[model samples]
Target chain A: MAFMIAQRAYIKLYLINKVEQRRGYGYQMLEELKEEFKPFGYVPPQSEIYRALHELVQEGVLYRTKQLKGNDPSVDFQEIVLYHFTDNGAEKAALYKKQVKTDLDRCIGMLHKAVADNFV
Target chain B: MAFMIAQRAYIKLYLINKVEQRRGYGYQMLEELKEEFKPFGYVPPQSEIYRALHELVQEGVLYRTKQLKGNDPSVDFQEIVLYHFTDNGAEKAALYKKQVKTDLDRCIGMLHKAVADNFV
Candidate 1:
């Protein structure tokens, strides 16, 4: 499950980068994943998301930046950490994307065969 | 990946039970998995398979029985551990099979959208 979550996180970051041309914070990514899996009745917990992001950073696939979020500099702003892909991270994300697709296909095929054989 | 491995082990055991009406040892299941994934250029390591089986046993989904494999009484036979599904395990395997199918559908859908958008 951690592996799948990490893959999902990498793909999510890649999608976010492609669509928004900006980095993503952990909370935002968590919310996005939650929404994505909502139909499947699975809500990814915040801790898992944070842990996955941290793992990615550890893998040198991402770097973190701390930024304050607020329009007014005089106000006490919320601090957030944003994740950006490193050069190696970007290459890995692409590779992971392809690998994930292939894995999903194989898994689906296996499940179908199992179901057809009444093995489940 | 470990979670998936556990799931695969459960499913493989279920299939073996249905077809052969027998339980499976760790090495047999590992060889089966290796053959199954060989087309994809992936061979699961024996350690991972054993780890997954142990995890399933810990989860109360499987129980182990040590059996001697040899027809000769005078010779020392190989001791092999076979895995059998618990009552609860049988139920969980059925449930996991359905869940895996649903999860795979959602995952494939997400990947297709990502691919269509060129997000990967």
Candidate 2:
């Protein structure tokens, strides 16, 4: 199901871009994705999400920045890593979008042929 | 690409069913599929095709029969194994068709959302 894979990629990109206006921590994005996919009876594994994020970072589609969490100076603060799209990332995302569209159209055509051929 | 995987399955099933009126040898189906996907800049691998065929056979969706090739009885006849759908396979194919349709609808919806969100 290339479409499903493409859909997952699209959703992940969308969440990363739109989550808090193009910035979100990995766990936050994963949670959001889980919620989004809950209706479909599928919950993405955390490892898979993390792996995808790692890949995006590797591809320069995203950059990671670490920030200190909590405001108290006396307490040990947690480090939170947030992902943001690089300038090149946006262009790549656009290209990916176009590719996904092409793939979608192709799949639709194949499905139609399958149905018409009565061997679906 | 879940859609692509599903499409491959659909195509394989379709080819097996429609090729020469529902009976074709493995290599013949593979060649036909290669031709079908040629315009898309893809050629299904021999291993993948054979694997899919094996799986289908294991699933009882198809039964194989061995036939001798060539016209002369004295000639060393080449054995050709042709695959044909079983009674149960037609029913399974119908169910698979319905599932593919559902998956297609879901993918279309996701793609629309991805585009509408402008993250694609």
Candidate 3:
């Protein structure tokens, strides 16, 4: 990919976009992104994905809530930390998505015009 | 712009694409690019654009030809240096353009799907 998007930055946007769609755990989001971007030849590394998620949390873009498994009232169950987008995170994610839309439209339009002018 | 392209790298691709479209001088291409990308809010700086062009020529992706203006074949005239895409440059530019088209289609599709799934 000659026009590769910055991986970490893209992952931040991706994280926010996914949480905006549906909140999930760090691992779940990573797997989802890998599957989503794999077809585009851009499945980011697992470590980088985790690092991005942690950074998002640290930067107050996301907050973690502890979820207990097995639905046992008395028994101690494994705790799963689910990531949720903050208000700011959601706002920024929407902005990022809009930016993506604008860029895609621009590039596609220019390329079409170029091809048409030259090829046709 | 949350998803900004790497400027230098992009300039390289942009230069090649422009020359492949039509050969022109360094200044002419810089002006052309400014106009081309201004609508996208991404007209690069003059220095960076020129630097990218120089680097491309140095890298053998482009070749320079000097053109003499004014009618007299033997008389002194202003010499204009034009940048042309080498065979490799044309090939690479075509590849870059194809890459851009692929990315545009992918991002647009994903964003459309995201919007449809979430908004619709």
Candidate 4:
């Protein structure tokens, strides 16, 4: 099942945050991510990710930069790909962000209340 | 590669929204999603997503509920696997949300300014 319990759930959550509201977030990269130093902690598996990229490209949800490869001799290999949201997509992404944040806030609120109530 | 542009970017964005600052979002569902009726637009691939969930569990970032399947005759199928952010994780998730929101706001602001600049 492509949408197994864990993956499906994560994708739904990913969509909420990545695609649900942002105008052009259909299929693309994070707008601003500088946390590559702690790569493993912050990075997801790269192989499977490309598949999503391919689908997004086909769906017109995302566009990618011509691949750029650079060598930082002492460090591991580096390949930087730049993906940008279409104008229509970026606007939508922003709108979605608010809706998602609101939903997330509500959930956080409920969790807090549940904890306070000692309902653990 | 799992971390293809579309998938990698989305995962990074997903981590930002789902894990960066919020308390306990490591491997979980969107906090509150009642928009299931529009499954294709909002829903993601289930098979691939299961992988992320399984990994999160292995990393001790998430825990899952026993699977529960529902019967809604008209619907394709219904199965809900509830997930909860551990106490420690939820707090981190909340914190991450702020950082992400801030980063996003900055990007949005920049895009707005750039558009106004007519540099495109």
Candidate 5:
């Protein structure tokens, strides 16, 4: 995460944004992120994703509910833990999204003008 | 720059891109960046700009030309040093621009999908 802070920040925002939309299991979220970021050529490490999820839960931005995994009706099987955002988590996610949008728009717009005005 | 690595990287790419496109003066580039980034609500500091410019020169990515200022013929006038990319500088700038474009497009595209798929 430290080595790839920029990517990490965006992933964080995307993760929280997803949680706010609907409840999600940790493994599912990681799988979804892997698929979503495939086009970007990034598959975030499993450990890093888990670390981020754990941090969010610790920060009280997310809550987890444990239930039986999938459709398997085995009492011996381990339960699945799904995550949901608190109200504060949702608010924070919205803010992070907005900030990313702002900075992206700004950087892209400025780069366009700088290249055009300076180079041309 | 440490606090805003994403923004800094973009700015560095933009600056190099501009230098490769046309010869420019340090002060002029700073002014242009300020105006261009105004929409994004960032005014990159003059010192930071100078530092970046100097670093590029030190790295042999840019060269400086000292010319007497203005059309007014006066020996008392101070010389203005303008910057331009060297052959290597132009090549480096092109590479940097390409990398920035790749990451930017990736980041922006993933963000759009993440927001749309999750938030919608």
Candidate 6:
């Protein structure tokens, strides 16, 4: 009931984008999300992005690797994140990506047909 | 380059939906994703979905709480996951949602404009 909504940038914003990008996780994924959001003309609140990511993990739609304690050697974020898709996550992201593409194609096709029937 | 591709049903589909719906995480989120995909005519591999989830945590994009032991008294999944978005994550998801809605609105408006311009 809740997850259902009109539609938002949130849709293809996260895991789905990563899958399409080949692969990514954590802050790197976040960076990618930002790039994706930019052309769309909005930058998701960093917090909200993190929240969605958090929710995904909680939902088991995503998986996290072991923690890095107080600080990781490489990144300053203090967390050693290694977000990944379970096979399930990958399959789902892929499936959704395909469907969205199909839907868009249909929408475009119908629009063009209507235009042709009426205008040209 | 990669993340910027055809808009898949996968977009406008994930955490953004959950956030727009209010909130959710974990296996529950997976269920939500599944429900979202069903109407589109495809189902993702469960393993893929899980893998995606795992990766998100690894990336630190999503947060995972303490894990339940091999077998918690309650569930059969052998994992107890509590996930929440970090502040940055929440902000980004919210921002992205607004932008997407705006894009869809613009697309809808243009379609109606053309129709009105052409018809009686």
Indicate which candidate wins on lDDT: 5
Between the candidate structures 3 and 4, which one is better when assessed by DockQ? Answer: 3
Pairs that collide, model 3: none
Q: Is the docking of candidate 6 incorrect, acceptable, medium or high quality?
A: incorrect
> What does the interface RMSD come to for each candidate?
5.8, 4.9, 7.1, 13.1, 7.1, 12.8
Candidate with the greatest DockQ versus the true structure: 2
Q: Residue B79 of candidate 6: its Cα lDDT?
A: 59
Point out the higher-scoring one by lDDT: 1 or 5.
Answer: 5
Candidate 3 CAPRI classification by DockQ: incorrect
Superposed model 6: Cα runs more than 4 Å off: A1-10, A19-23, A66-77, A106-120, B1-120
Ranking by TM-score: 2, 5, 3, 1, 6, 4
Best by TM-score: 2
- Could you give the DockQ of candidate 3? 0.15
lDDT of each: 0.59, 0.64, 0.66, 0.39, 0.66, 0.50
Angstrom error of the Cα, residue A78, model 3: value is: 5.6
Candidate number that wins on DockQ, 1 or 6: 1
Fnat per model, in the order shown: 0.02, 0.17, 0.04, 0.04, 0.15, 0.00
As a TM-score, model 2 comes out at 0.73
* Lowest lDDT block of 10, candidate 1 chain A: A1-10
Interface RMSD of 4: 13.1
What tens-digit string does per-residue lDDT give for candidate 2 at A75-117? 9578888888888887776676577666655655654555556
Docking class of 2: acceptable
Tell how far residue A27 is off in model 4, in angstroms: 31
Residue range with the least summed lDDT across 10 consecutive positions in model 2 chain A? A1-10
Model 1: CA > 4 A from native: A1-23, A87-89, B1-17, B20-37, B40-120
lDDT score for residue B20 of model 3 = 65
Better candidate by TM-score, 1 or 6:
1
Q: Provide the RMSD of all predictions against the true structure, rounded to 1 decimal.
A: 5.9, 4.1, 5.5, 15.1, 5.3, 21.1
lDDT (Cα, tens digit) per residue for candidate 1, span B1-120: 111324445444444343234636766766776676565455566666677677677877778888777777579678877888887777876675566556555554554444555434
Could you tell me the TM-score of candidate 3? 0.63
- 2 or 6: which has the higher TM-score? 2
Least accurate stretch of 10 residues (summed lDDT) in model 5 chain A?
Answer: A1-10
Q: Write one digit per residue (lDDT tens) for candidate 4, span A7-108.
A: 222222243334333422322433322132133233433443455455545555456564424455456464466555655755554554454444444333
